[model samples]
Target: NGFKLKEGRFKLDIRKKFFTLRVVRYWNRLPREVVAAPSLEAFKARLDEALGNLV
Candidate 1:
Protein backbone atom coordinates (compact mmCIF):
# COMPACT_ATOMS: atom_id res chain seq x y z
CA ASN A 1 0.00 0.00 0.00
CA GLY A 2 1.35 3.37 -1.05
CA PHE A 3 0.07 6.49 0.67
CA LYS A 4 1.56 9.95 0.48
CA LEU A 5 1.65 11.74 3.81
CA LYS A 6 1.19 15.48 3.55
CA GLU A 7 1.07 18.03 6.37
CA GLY A 8 -1.66 19.96 4.58
CA ARG A 9 -4.17 17.31 5.66
CA PHE A 10 -2.47 15.61 8.60
CA LYS A 11 -0.27 16.02 11.67
CA LEU A 12 3.26 14.64 11.80
CA ASP A 13 5.77 14.63 14.62
CA ILE A 14 9.13 13.70 13.17
CA ARG A 15 12.12 13.45 15.45
CA LYS A 16 15.47 11.70 15.56
CA LYS A 17 14.20 8.83 17.68
CA PHE A 18 10.46 8.91 17.34
CA PHE A 19 7.80 9.80 14.79
CA THR A 20 4.06 10.33 15.02
CA LEU A 21 1.70 10.45 12.08
CA ARG A 22 -1.90 11.45 12.57
CA VAL A 23 -4.72 11.97 10.18
CA VAL A 24 -6.37 15.34 10.68
CA ARG A 25 -8.52 15.65 7.58
CA TYR A 26 -9.67 12.11 7.09
CA TRP A 27 -12.34 12.85 4.54
CA ASN A 28 -11.76 10.74 1.41
CA ARG A 29 -8.48 9.11 2.37
CA LEU A 30 -9.22 7.49 5.69
CA PRO A 31 -6.30 5.47 6.93
CA ARG A 32 -6.62 1.75 6.71
CA GLU A 33 -3.73 1.09 9.07
CA VAL A 34 -1.34 2.89 11.38
CA VAL A 35 2.27 2.06 12.15
CA ALA A 36 4.91 3.76 14.28
CA ALA A 37 8.29 3.02 15.83
CA PRO A 38 9.71 4.21 19.12
CA SER A 39 13.22 4.58 17.75
CA LEU A 40 14.85 5.74 14.56
CA GLU A 41 16.57 2.44 14.03
CA ALA A 42 13.30 0.63 14.24
CA PHE A 43 11.68 3.08 11.91
CA LYS A 44 14.40 2.69 9.33
CA ALA A 45 14.18 -1.05 9.57
CA ARG A 46 10.47 -0.92 8.92
CA LEU A 47 10.99 1.39 5.98
CA ASP A 48 13.65 -0.89 4.56
CA GLU A 49 11.37 -3.87 4.85
CA ALA A 50 8.57 -2.07 3.06
CA LEU A 51 10.89 -0.91 0.30
CA GLY A 52 12.35 -4.35 -0.12
CA ASN A 53 8.90 -5.76 -0.62
CA LEU A 54 8.28 -3.31 -3.39
CA VAL A 55 11.35 -4.44 -5.26
Candidate 2:
Protein backbone atom coordinates (compact mmCIF):
# COMPACT_ATOMS: atom_id res chain seq x y z
CA ASN A 1 0.00 0.00 0.00
CA GLY A 2 1.53 3.26 -1.20
CA PHE A 3 0.98 6.50 0.69
CA LYS A 4 0.86 8.61 -2.44
CA LEU A 5 -2.37 10.14 -3.57
CA LYS A 6 -3.09 11.26 -7.12
CA GLU A 7 -3.57 15.01 -6.99
CA GLY A 8 -6.59 16.19 -8.89
CA ARG A 9 -6.37 18.87 -11.54
CA PHE A 10 -7.66 22.24 -10.43
CA LYS A 11 -9.06 24.89 -12.71
CA LEU A 12 -8.70 27.65 -10.17
CA ASP A 13 -6.08 28.61 -7.58
CA ILE A 14 -8.72 28.48 -4.87
CA ARG A 15 -9.10 24.75 -5.43
CA LYS A 16 -5.61 24.28 -4.04
CA LYS A 17 -6.90 25.56 -0.70
CA PHE A 18 -9.24 22.56 -0.37
CA PHE A 19 -8.41 20.27 2.55
CA THR A 20 -7.85 17.22 0.37
CA LEU A 21 -5.49 19.10 -1.93
CA ARG A 22 -3.56 20.56 1.00
CA VAL A 23 -3.22 17.17 2.69
CA VAL A 24 -2.08 15.52 -0.52
CA ARG A 25 0.70 18.07 -0.88
CA TYR A 26 1.95 17.35 2.62
CA TRP A 27 1.53 13.58 2.28
CA ASN A 28 3.53 13.42 -0.91
CA ARG A 29 6.50 14.99 0.83
CA LEU A 30 6.99 12.15 3.34
CA PRO A 31 9.92 9.77 2.93
CA ARG A 32 9.01 6.52 1.19
CA GLU A 33 10.32 4.44 4.10
CA VAL A 34 7.97 6.23 6.45
CA VAL A 35 5.02 5.76 4.17
CA ALA A 36 5.76 2.11 3.53
CA ALA A 37 5.75 0.97 7.17
CA PRO A 38 4.12 -2.45 7.51
CA SER A 39 2.18 -1.69 10.67
CA LEU A 40 0.71 1.25 12.58
CA GLU A 41 3.32 1.09 15.32
CA ALA A 42 6.13 0.91 12.80
CA PHE A 43 4.64 3.82 10.92
CA LYS A 44 4.51 5.96 14.03
CA ALA A 45 8.08 5.12 14.94
CA ARG A 46 9.36 5.84 11.47
CA LEU A 47 7.43 9.06 11.30
CA ASP A 48 8.76 10.18 14.65
CA GLU A 49 12.30 9.36 13.63
CA ALA A 50 11.96 11.10 10.33
CA LEU A 51 10.50 14.23 11.92
CA GLY A 52 13.17 14.25 14.57
CA ASN A 53 15.81 14.39 11.87
CA LEU A 54 14.24 17.58 10.59
CA VAL A 55 15.10 19.32 13.83
Candidate 3:
Protein backbone atom coordinates (compact mmCIF):
# COMPACT_ATOMS: atom_id res chain seq x y z
CA ASN A 1 0.00 0.00 0.00
CA GLY A 2 1.06 3.54 -0.77
CA PHE A 3 2.11 5.31 2.41
CA LYS A 4 2.18 8.83 1.08
CA LEU A 5 -0.27 11.20 -0.52
CA LYS A 6 0.72 13.77 -3.10
CA GLU A 7 0.25 17.31 -1.90
CA GLY A 8 -1.33 19.77 -4.26
CA ARG A 9 0.56 22.84 -5.38
CA PHE A 10 -0.58 26.08 -3.77
CA LYS A 11 -0.30 29.59 -5.07
CA LEU A 12 -0.66 31.22 -1.64
CA ASP A 13 0.54 30.43 1.87
CA ILE A 14 -3.03 30.41 3.16
CA ARG A 15 -3.86 27.64 0.71
CA LYS A 16 -1.53 25.32 2.58
CA LYS A 17 -3.83 25.46 5.60
CA PHE A 18 -6.91 24.40 3.68
CA PHE A 19 -8.68 21.36 5.16
CA THR A 20 -7.68 18.98 2.40
CA LEU A 21 -4.08 20.11 2.43
CA ARG A 22 -3.88 20.04 6.21
CA VAL A 23 -5.31 16.56 6.36
CA VAL A 24 -2.94 15.34 3.70
CA ARG A 25 0.02 16.72 5.59
CA TYR A 26 -1.04 15.08 8.83
CA TRP A 27 -1.85 11.82 7.10
CA ASN A 28 1.56 11.67 5.53
CA ARG A 29 3.23 11.93 8.92
CA LEU A 30 1.48 8.85 10.32
CA PRO A 31 3.39 5.61 10.76
CA ARG A 32 3.21 3.07 7.98
CA GLU A 33 1.56 0.45 10.23
CA VAL A 34 -1.15 2.89 11.22
CA VAL A 35 -1.76 3.97 7.62
CA ALA A 36 -1.77 0.38 6.45
CA ALA A 37 -4.27 -0.87 9.02
CA PRO A 38 -6.59 -3.35 7.43
CA SER A 39 -9.82 -1.79 8.69
CA LEU A 40 -11.13 1.54 9.90
CA GLU A 41 -11.69 0.24 13.43
CA ALA A 42 -8.22 -1.27 13.53
CA PHE A 43 -6.73 1.99 12.27
CA LYS A 44 -8.47 3.98 14.97
CA ALA A 45 -7.37 1.57 17.66
CA ARG A 46 -3.78 1.60 16.46
CA LEU A 47 -3.71 5.37 16.09
CA ASP A 48 -5.20 5.89 19.54
CA GLU A 49 -2.66 3.55 21.07
CA ALA A 50 0.14 5.31 19.28
CA LEU A 51 -0.99 8.78 20.22
CA GLY A 52 -1.61 7.86 23.81
CA ASN A 53 2.09 7.41 24.40
CA LEU A 54 2.67 11.10 23.72
CA VAL A 55 0.73 12.23 26.74
RMSD of each: 10.0, 2.3, 1.9
CA lDDT of 13 in candidate 2? 97
**Which 10 residues in a row give candidate 3 its minimum summed lDDT?**
1-10
Q: How high is the CA lDDT of each candidate model?
A: 0.45, 0.88, 0.86
Query: lDDT by residue for model 3 over 1-55, one digit each (tens)?
Result: 2688899997899988788888887788788888999999999998998788668
- What's the ranking of the predictions by lDDT, best on top? 2, 3, 1
Whole-structure CA lDDT of model 3: 0.86
Q: Give the TM-score ranking, best first.
A: 3, 2, 1
Clashing pairs in 2: none
Minimal lDDT window, size 10, model 2: 1-10
Q: After superposition, how far is residue 18 of candidate 2 from its true place, in Å?
A: 3.6
lDDT of 2 at 26: 68
Model 1: per-residue Cα lDDT over 9-49, one tens digit each: 32543532233334433322432232355577875776667
TM-score of 3: 0.75
Question: Given candidate 2, what's the lDDT at residue 36?
Answer: 92
For model 1, the superposed segments whose C-alpha errors exceed 4 Å read: 1-4, 7-35
